[model samples]
Target: MELNNEVIINNLVKRFDEIVAVNEVSLEVPAGSIFGLLGPNGAGKSTTLRLLCTLLRPDSGTASVAGHDILEEPVNVRECTGVLPEEGSHTLYPSLTSYENLEYFAKLYDVPEEEAKKRIEDLLKFMDLWERRNDPAGELSTGNRQRLALCRALLHNPSVLLLDEPTSSLDPIAAKRVRELILKLAKQYGQTFFINSHNLAEVQRLCDYIAIIDEGKILLSGRTDELRRRLQSKQVFKLRVADNIETAKSIAEGLDFIFDVSIESDSLMLTILDPVSNNSVLIRKLLNANIAIIELAEEEMTLEDLYLQVIKEEEQ
Candidate 1:
C-alpha cells in the first residue's frame, strides 16, 4: 500500500513562555520512507517531533499521524506510532530484563499475549540479544542496551517511528547495524520513519527526503538526491597536474565558465557555476594544451557543508 501522508503538519507553532520553539512550520512525510529532520542543536527538530507524537500539543497547528488527527484523535495516533526519544534511557526500565521490558511495553500497547511472545522472541533474535534476553537491562553494555531500547520501541509493530538521534551514542559498528535495521523494517513492514539527526553522512545515506531547519524555521527541504543535484551546479572541481600548475591556473582563469581557479603545489582547483555538463569540455581544453592531468575530480559539497552554509547564512 502506498503511504498517504503518514505524517502531516501545517502551520505548526509552539512556544515555551517567552521562547518560540516552532514557528508556523509545515512538512509532510510520505508513507514507507525515511524522512530526515536535520538541524543544529536548537533548530526545533525535537519540538516538531513532539508535536507529531502527541507528547506536547502545539500552541497552534494541525497534524495527523497515520490519518489520525493530533488534536482530535491523539490516542489513536499514539497507538499507531512509536517514538525513540533522544535519550533512549527514558524509555527503558534499567532494572528489568530485556525480555521482561518488552513484555511490559507490549502489554501496555495491548498486544495479545501469544503474538507478543512470538514478536518479542523474534525481535530479540533479530537484534542478536536472545542469549542475553534474561540479563538485566542495566547490566547490558551501552550498545546492547541501545539495541534493546530499539526493540522496545518496535514491540507493538508501530506503523510510524519517530526517532531522535537513534545512533548518537552508538559506536560505528552498532550505528551501521541500526541503519540497516531501519531500512529492513521500512521495506518489510512498509513502515514510515521520521528521523531527527545531526549526522549528515548518515542522513544522506539513509533518508530519502531531508529538511534542514534552523531557528524554528525550515531552511530547505527536498529529495536528498535532488538537493545534491541542485548543489552540483555550484560544485568546485579539483585538477591535479603533473607539472606547470601555474600555467594551467592561468589558462583556467581566462575561461568564463571556470569561474575561479586557485593553484597549489601541483594542482589547480576550479570553482565553477555549473560543471555538470561542462566537465568534459574543461578536461579536453586542458589536455589539448598539454596540461598532463594527473587527477581531475569534482569536490562535491557534503550534506554537512550545505548544512553549515545554511546555518551561517541564517545567522547573518
Candidate 2:
C-alpha cells in the first residue's frame, strides 16, 4: 500500500457457514481523513471492522491497515491502530478506577510511565473525567464510560482509529464534545479515523467521506458533499400564497425551469432546476396572475433524505 493510504481493502470477503457476512468489499481510506461506514442493522459493518482490525481473518480477499497487511502482519496492524468496538466498555475493568484503567492500558501498550501519566492526565481533563478519575469505572455513567474508552483508545496515540458507534451512548452535549475532540485530534495529529455508524446525521457532520452498505454490498461511496449533490438534482421550494393557489401552481408548472408543482391548500410547492435564478421568474409569473405570495422558502436536503433515496433506488 502507498504511504498516503491508511487503509486498503481489495475484494475482502468473510463468511460463517452459509451466511456471507461480508462480500467482495473494497475501499480505500486516505491517511488523516475521517471516513464513515454507514449501514442498517446486521449489514456486516461490525464484521468488516473486525476484518480490518485483524480480530477476524477474511475467508477470501485481502486488506491492509496503516500499511500493514492484516493477515501477514496482524501484530503491526494492531500496534498502529486503536479500536473502540460497539460494546466499548467491554475492554474496561469494572474494579479499576477510571485513571487506573487508562494507566493499565497505557502500560500494556508499552507507553513509558512518565509519558503515560501526562497523557492520561491531559485526556481525563479534556474529556471532563478528571473530577471522577479516582472513581471505579463501573460506577461511571454510560456516557462517561464511553468517553473513558475513547480516551483509552487514544492513550497510545496510534495513527489509525477504528471506532464503531463512538457516540452511541453519549448524550447530545457529550456527543458534540466527542465530535469536536475527534476533529481536533484528526487535524492536529493527522490521525486517520474509520468509523462505523448508523447515525446518518452524525456521520454527515463529522466524516469527509462516506460509504453506504447493505446486505454485505456497497451501494454508494464518495465525498459526503459530492454524494449529496449527486443525489439532489432539483431544488424544492415551499411557497405559501394568500390567494389563487391554483393560479400559482399553474404558473410554476408552465415555467420551463420548474419541473413539478404540487398544491396543498393555500400553499404551492415547486420543483425548480435553479432556485436562485428561477425563483424570481416564478414570483413574477404569480404576481402577474394576481396571486398573493405569503411565504417562500427552499427546502434543504438532509442526509437522512439522501440515505433513504439511495437505499430505495438500490431496492428498485
TM-scores of all candidate predictions against the true structure: 0.85, 0.84
Q: Write the per-residue lDDT of candidate 1 for residues 185-277, one digit (tens) a residue.
A: 888788899999877778888999999887798888889999767666666778998887887887788788886578766778787767767
Q: Which stretches of candidate 1 lie over 4 Å from their true place?
A: 1-3, 241-248, 259-269, 285-293, 308-316
What's the distance in Å from true for residue 189, model 1?
Answer: 0.4
Q: Highest TM-score: which candidate?
A: 1
List of clashing residue pairs for candidate 2: none
Residue-level lDDT for 218 in candidate 1: 84
Taken over the whole model, the C-alpha lDDT of each candidate is 0.86, 0.87
Residue 92's C-alpha lDDT in candidate 1? 84
* Model 2 misplaced regions, further than 4 Å: 1-3, 235-272, 287-294, 298-304, 311-316
Locate the minimum summed-lDDT window of 10 residues in model 1: 300-309
Instruction: Residues 1-316, candidate 2: write the lDDT tens digits.
Output: 6548899999999999898889899999999899999887888899999999999989999999988999999999999998999889778998999999999999999999999999999989888899999999999988889889999998988899999988877889888888888898888788999999888778888999999877788878989899767655566778998877777777787889986588877777776775667778888878888888899987765545555667667798
